[model samples]
Target: MSSPDVPSMTGVHVVVMGVSGSGKSTVAAALAERLTLPFGEGDEFHGERNRALMAAGVPLTDADRAPWLLAVRDWMSAQAPTGSVVACSALRRAYRDVLRGALGDVLFLEVDVPAAVLRARMSARTEHFMPVSLLDSQLATLEPLAADEPGARVDGSASPAAVVEACLAAVRLRCDA
Candidate 1:
């Protein structure tokens, strides 16, 4: 679906979420550019403690993520008047709920990929703090968004451009509804 056909975001917040290596940041960036919205990388909100833990190849507990999620929520809330796209590894339902509390009209775009593919991507990636060893824990903690949730799921195996297209199509469909 083309942009014009989608509900015009007089003001709507979109979140792109997935586990590590699922291309949330990449897809969010492209979507933000295409939609002419501001982009926020969720990783940037990670506190120093969380960053240190992840850098040491340790998986974060939910407590470790709460503050980070709240910060992102605040950012999203602040951007509601202008609209924004945020890239977050919102691996659990509660996390999504927290975000929804701040931005009621939030739309989640989930990037889905197999663990094996994600592992491969993590292994090949450089300069990223998230380690391959933490992938299993993330997968374990993940609670996928229900179908009734205002969201779209895109296969991460496709090229980035294709994934972006799929995301746009899903967003358009949801907005049109």
Candidate 2:
């Protein structure tokens, strides 16, 4: 469990989560850079088959997502002692639970954004394997952070800098508690 102290002083671990194009990577990387913590991109942990399935516009089933989620969770667990920030879709409560169990009470930074904005961002990106077509399924699968969760929901419609600032403020407040 994280102590109620400044995260930077206490080595807090955070997961920046959202559907594809919600700016999870951008905001998480910025936040990590600001906090001087190690950063990991969730997509990079996907297996070739998973990436291929997503690239083909197929929505991943829970069965298909399990291994990848466990990988991300393990990475987060490994980073815990040193503190880190990770960008993961973490679209379901079960997924977040896996992470929580691994990290033992980590903070989740949900990058909540409008559907239109998400579509626009997905359309603009060309290098990522996730197609805009899968956004609906992703959204459908997404379970927003609950009130009891140890984290904050951030507005992803804002600039990345703004989003990172908001995340920092929210996490700091949580840490201060």
Candidate 3:
């Protein structure tokens, strides 16, 4: 920790990002639990229109996503003093920029998974509104974390436990790793 009074995780915003069905929510929630931070489910920020579009297998455009990103950004800002772990698709660099704009140094944890695996996961899932048909759109729109971005990437193909372990390591900002 930077100071005796502060927790090491203080003000550390980690956005777990990936395409639909890539396990962003699972990894992020577990990471938050491990770090004892609040967790935000990105999908919950989606407007009714956005949800409807994804449910219909339609890809969301930048214009369509602007408000939703702002909402997520605002939520992060609200938790600024405490820090948070949020799961967001963050499919494009622009989307991530919105998040970073809210807090100057938000960390992004990109979860990478194969398209086939994403398809299988989306198909097997019964809860999410995102459809398997939209997987291609998400895959095509995904932009890996940029070199200048403050973040880390992990293989989402790993078990949920392994994914959480990897995320926790990154969120700690350890020097040894």
* TM-score of each candidate structure, all chains considered together: 0.95, 0.94, 0.92
Q: What is candidate 1's TM-score against the reference?
A: 0.95
Identify the runs in model 2 with alpha carbons over 4 angstroms from their true place. 1-6, 9-11
Q: Which stretches of candidate 3 lie over 4 Å from their true place?
A: 1-7, 174-177
Give the residue spans of candidate 1 off by over 4 A.
Answer: 1-6
Tens digit of per-residue lDDT, candidate 2, span 10-109: 3467899999999999999998887777899999999999999999999999999999988988887787777788999899989988888765458999
lDDT of 3: 0.86
Candidate 1: tens digits of C-alpha lDDT, residues 1-177:
225644576467899999999999999999988888889999999999999999998889888999999999999998988778999998898999999976548999999999999999999999999999999999999889888888978898899999998998888888778
How would the candidate models be sorted by TM-score, starting from the highest? 1, 2, 3
| lDDT agreement with native, every candidate | 0.89, 0.88, 0.86
Decreasing lDDT order of the candidates: 1, 2, 3
Per-residue C-alpha lDDT of model 3 across residues 1-177, encoded as one tens digit per residue: 243322376676889999988999999998887777789999999999999998988889999999999999999998888788899999889899899976535889999999889999989999889889888888889989998888988989999999887777776553223
Best by lDDT: 1
